[model samples]
Target: MLIYTGGTFGMVYDEDGSLAPFNFSLVIEKIPELQSLDLKLTVISFPDPVDSSNVDIEHWQAMAYIIKDHYEQYDAFVILHGTDTMAYTASALSFMFRGINKPIILTGAQIPIGATRSDARENLITALEIASTKNGKVPMLNEIAVYFNYYLLKGNRSQKIRSSNFAAFESENFPYLAESGVKIVFNESFMNTHDPQQKLEFYPKMDPNVVVLKIFPGITEEVVKSILNIKGLKGVVIESYGSGNIMSWRWMEELLRDAVSRGIFLYNVSQCMGGSVVQGRYETSKMLSDIGVISGHDITTEAALAKLMHLLGTERNVDIIKQKLNVSIRGELTVV
Candidate 1:
C-alpha cells in the first residue's frame, strides 16, 4: 500500500507550468518500472495535501489509524511525505505502532517528480522495493524507517541535518539500517528485531502540549521562565550543551526545579548530533539530573519531542512516562 500525504515527491507541472501535486493514481505512467516489480499496488492520498510544516496531531492520527485499519490486509506500507517534518512523523509512527511485524517505509524527494532532474523517481522506487523485500516468508524489515538518497535509516533515529543536499537525513547516533549502491546491503546486526508473538500496538493519541527548549549562550531567565511556564504545557525536550550540560546558573536551576514541581516533564537530550546524554558526567548537568529531568541518552531532538508527546497523550502516570523516557521504547534511543 502506498499512502500519499503530500510532498515534493508527488508534484508535477500543471497547465500554467506551476508545480502541483499530480494524480498518484496515474503514477504507473510516470514510473513504469513499478509494473516490472510484479506486485499489487494501491494508492491512498490525503483529501487535501499540506506541506510537512503544517502536519500536526490530526495528520499523525490519520496516518496511524490508516495503518491500523489496514494492518491485516497489507504486507507492507510506504508513505510519501514532505522532507521538513518527515523525521518527526516517522518517530511518532514508530512509537504508535510498537512491535509492528511489517515494513513501513517513508520517503520523499528534494525536488519535484515532474522535473527532469528530480530525485523523486529513485527514492520512491527504492522505497517500494525495500518495503516489499522479504527474508524467506517473513518481512526483512519490521519497523518504521526512512529511505532517502541512498541510505535507509531507522525512523526514530533519523534527523534531517541538511536542507539543500540530496543526503538530507542522517542517523548520527545510530548506524544506517541499509545502504543502496550496486545492491542494498542490510546491516542485520543494527536492525530492530521483534518477537514473533508480539502484537502490534496502535496508539492514535499524541499530545501536542510539548515544546523543545534549546539552550543557548547568554539566554535570559525571563525567556527560560516564560517557556517553562507556558499554560497547559506537559513536557519539554531540552536541547542541552555537550553531554547534556547546561549553565550552572542558580536562576535556571530554580526555574527547572519549579517546573518539575508543577508536574512538567523535562527531558534532556544532547545538542550534538553524535553523542549520548550523560546527565551527571559534568557538574553543569548534575542539577538537571537532581531535579528529576529524564535523560534522553542518544535520542535525537526530533525523536525526543515525538516520544514526549506520545507518552503525554497515552500515559497519565508520571512515573510510567518517566520510566519509558529513560528506556528505548521503539529503538528511538540507546541506553548505553
Candidate 2:
C-alpha cells in the first residue's frame, strides 16, 4: 500500500496559479508508467495536508496507528512525505515501529510533481519497486528507509544535507542499503534485517519534555543556564563541536552536575558530519565524561533527538534511559 502524507509531490497549480494539493486518486493517471509494473497498488492520504515542519507527536502517533491498522493486509508500504523533516520522521518511525518486518520506505521530491522538471515520478517509481522487492517471498528490505536521488538510505542514519539539489539526503554514519543506476546495487554485507518471528512493537507518542542545545563559541553562562533550566525538561541533546568538545568552565560544570543530580539524561553528539563523539578524548570533552554525559558516538542530531524522545517517552527511569542511549537501537549510533 502507498500512503501520501502531503508534500510537493501531491501539489498542482490552481486556477489562480497558486500551488495546492490535488486529488491523490489521480496518482496512477498522472504517472501512467505504473500500469506496466506488476504490483497491487493502493493509495491512502491524510485528510489534511501537513507541512513536514508542523509534524509533532500527534502526527507520529496517527501515522503509527494507520500503519498498524493495515499491517496485516499489505506486503509493504511506501510513504510520500515532505522533505523538510523527512529525517526527523524517519528516525521517529524507526523507534515507533520496532521489529517491524515489512519494508517501510519514505520518499519525497525536491520539486513538485506538477512542475516541468519535477523529480517526483522517478522517486515514486523507484520507491514502489524497492518496497515490492523480494527474495522468494520475504522482502529484501524489512526496515524503515528513505529512498531519494537513486539511493536507498537507512531512515535513522539519514540527514538532509541539501535543499536545492536532487540529492537532498545522505547517510553520513552508515552506508546506504542500495543504489539505483544501470542496475540497482545492493550492499548485502552492510544491510540490516528484522527478525520475522519477532513481534512488532508500537510506540504511539514521544515525551515532549526534551530540548536540543547547539553549542557555539563564546556562549554566555546566562544562555546555557536558561536552557538547562527549562521547566520539567527530562532530556537534552547537546550538539557539541568536533569530537563533542564544548567550553570548559566551572559554571558549566556546576550546571551540568546539577541537571544530572536532578535526574536529567544528557547526551553529547558531534555537530560535524562523519565525526564521532568521544567524550574523554579532549580536555574540553573530558569534563563531560567526568560529569556523566552520555556519548552519542557518531549519531546524527536528528536521530539523537528522536532517540532521546523515544527513550524518555517509553522508559521513565533516567538511569535506564542513559544506558539505552549509549547502546545501539535500530542502528542510530555506533556504540563504542
Candidate 3:
C-alpha cells in the first residue's frame, strides 16, 4: 500500500481560499489511472498535514515508525511528502533504515493534485510503479529515493533548485538512478540490494544545537563572534562565498579560532546555489582551512542541517564526525 503523508501532492485549495492537506484516501476515485495500476493502495495521512518547511526530525521518526509497522504487509511503500524537506527526510531515512528490502519511494509535486496541469498524477503513479516492480522474489528498488520531474534521485543527494518550475529539484554531484519516459530506464548497477538478515531500525533523536552562518559582503566579525558565543553550540555550518571564500579579517580569524578551540565542530560549505566547497584552494578561504573548518563539499543547507543533527545525535567522535561530514554517507555530497 502507498502511504500518503501530508504534502503538496495531497493539498487542495479550499472554498475560503486557504490551501490545506486533503485526505488522500478520499481522492482515489478522482484519479482514474490508479484503477488501471491494479494495485491495492491505502493511504495514511497525519491528522494535520505539515508543510515540508516545517518538517523536523520528530516527524521523520514518526514516518519511519509507520513504515516499519507496516513493512511486511505492503509489497513496497511510496511516501508523499512536501518538497521543501523531502531530500532531508530521504537522506535521514537512508541511514535510519539500515536494511530495507523494499522500495521506499518518496515523491511530491509543485502543483496540487487537483489542478488541471498538476504534475502530481505522473510523479505519484510513477513512484508507485517503481515501488511495486520486482523480479520474481526481488524488489526493483531497495533504497530511499525521491521521484520528481521524471527522475528518481537518491534521496540524500538531491536539493531543491527552483521554486516555481515543474522540475524544481536536482541531485548535485550525482547521476539519477532512473528517469521516467516511454520506459523506466534504471541504472541497474547503482541499485542497492538489501541483506535480509539486517533489521529496520529508527534513529529518532536529532540535536538542534547547530547553527548555519552564511558569509556575505559586509558580514561583521562582531556578528560571527556573537553567534559563536551562543552557549552550548555544538556545530556551525558556515556558508562561505564561492569556492568557500571568507573574509580574512583578524577578528574573524580569532573568532573562528576560538570556536574551534572550544570543540565546536566547524563546517565550511559554499554559499553558491551549486558547486562544491574547495577549501585551501584560494587565499581568501585559506584562513578558514587553517582554522580547522571541515569542508562540506556540495551538500545543500537542508541536507547539511539534517546530517549534522543525525551525526550529533548518534556519534561523539569529533574527528570521525568531521571526516564523515565531508564524505557522502548516502550520496548527499561529493568530498574533494
Candidate 4:
C-alpha cells in the first residue's frame, strides 16, 4: 500500500505549465511498470495535498489513523512525503508506530515524476520493492525508514542534507540499513529488527508544547530566559553547540535550573550532525547534567523534538519522563 501526502514526486505540469499535484488515481498509470512488480497495489491520498512545510500535528494524527485502520490489510506501507519536512514526519511516525512488525518505508523525490530527469521513478520503485521484502512470510524489515537516493535509513536517524541532489537524506549517527547498488544490499547487522508477534502499539498522542533553542556564539541571556520561561512549555530541546557545550554563565545555569524546578522537561543535544551529546564531558556542559538536563546522546534534533513530544504527551510523572528521554525508545537515541 502507498500513502500520498503530497510532494514533488506527486506533481506534474498542468496545462498552464505550472506544477500541480497529479491525481493519485493515476499514480499507477504514471508508472505502468509498477504493474510488473507482481503485487496488488492500493493507494490512499490526502484530500488536499499539503506542502511538507505546512504539515502539522493534525496531519500526523490523520496519517497515523489511516495506518492504524488499514494495517491489517496491507503487507507493508510506503509514504510519499515532501522532502522539506520529511525527516520530521518520518521521525514522528517512528515514535507513533512504536512496535510495528511490518516495514513502513517513507520516500520522496527531489524532482517530479513528470520531469525529464526526475529521480522519482527509481525512488518509488525501489521503495515499493523494499516494502515487499519478506522472509518466509515475515517482513524482513520491521521499522520506519527513509529510502532516498539508493540508501535506506532509519527514519528517526535521517536528515535532509541537500535540496538539489538526489541523495538528499543522510543518517549520520547510524549506518544505512541497506544500500541500493547493483543489487539492493541489506546490511542486516545494522538494521533494526523486531518480533513479528508483538502487537503494534500506536502512540498518537504527541504533545506539541515543545520548542528547540539552537545556541549560537553570541546567544543572549534574555533570549535564553524568554524561551525557557515560556508559559505552558512542557519540554525544550537545546541544540547546544558542538558536543553539547553552552555558555557557562551563572545566570544561564540559573534559568535552566528554574525550568527544571518548574517541572518542565529539558534535553541537551548537539548541534553537530554526527557526535553524541556527552553532557558532563566539559565544564560548560557539566552544569546541564548536574541540573537535571537529559542527555540526548547522538540523537538528531528532529528525533529529540519528536521523542520529547511523545514522552510529554503520554507520560505524566516527571521522573519517568526524564528517564525515558535519556533512554533509547525505538532506537532514537544511544543512551550513555
lDDT of 2 by residue, 189-306 (tens): 7766646788888887688888998999888889988999999998899999999999988998999989988888889999998979999888999999999999999999899899
Model 1: colliding residue pairs: none
Question: lDDT per residue, candidate 3, 224-275, as tens digits?
Answer: 8889999989899899888888888888888999999998888887777678
Candidate-wise lDDT, in order: 0.92, 0.89, 0.83, 0.89
7, model 2: CA deviation in Å? Answer: 1.6
User: Clashing residue pairs in candidate 3, if any?
Assistant: none
Candidate 1 per-residue C-alpha lDDT over 72-178 given as tens digits, one digit per residue, 9 for 90 to 100:
99999999999999999999998888789999999999999999989988899888998898878888898999999999999999999998999999999899999
Query: Any idea what lDDT model 2 has?
Result: 0.89
User: How displaced is residue 280 in candidate 1, in Å?
Assistant: 1.1
Which regions of candidate 2 deviate over 4 angstroms?
Answer: none
> Quick one: how many clashes does candidate 3 have?
0
Top-down TM-score ranking = 1, 4, 2, 3
**Candidate with the larger TM-score of 1 and 3:** 1
Global Cα RMSD, each model: 1.0, 1.1, 2.1, 1.0
Best by lDDT: 1
- Stretches of candidate 4 off by over 4 Å are none
TM-scores for candidates 1 onward, in order = 0.98, 0.98, 0.92, 0.98
| Best-to-worst lDDT order | 1, 4, 2, 3
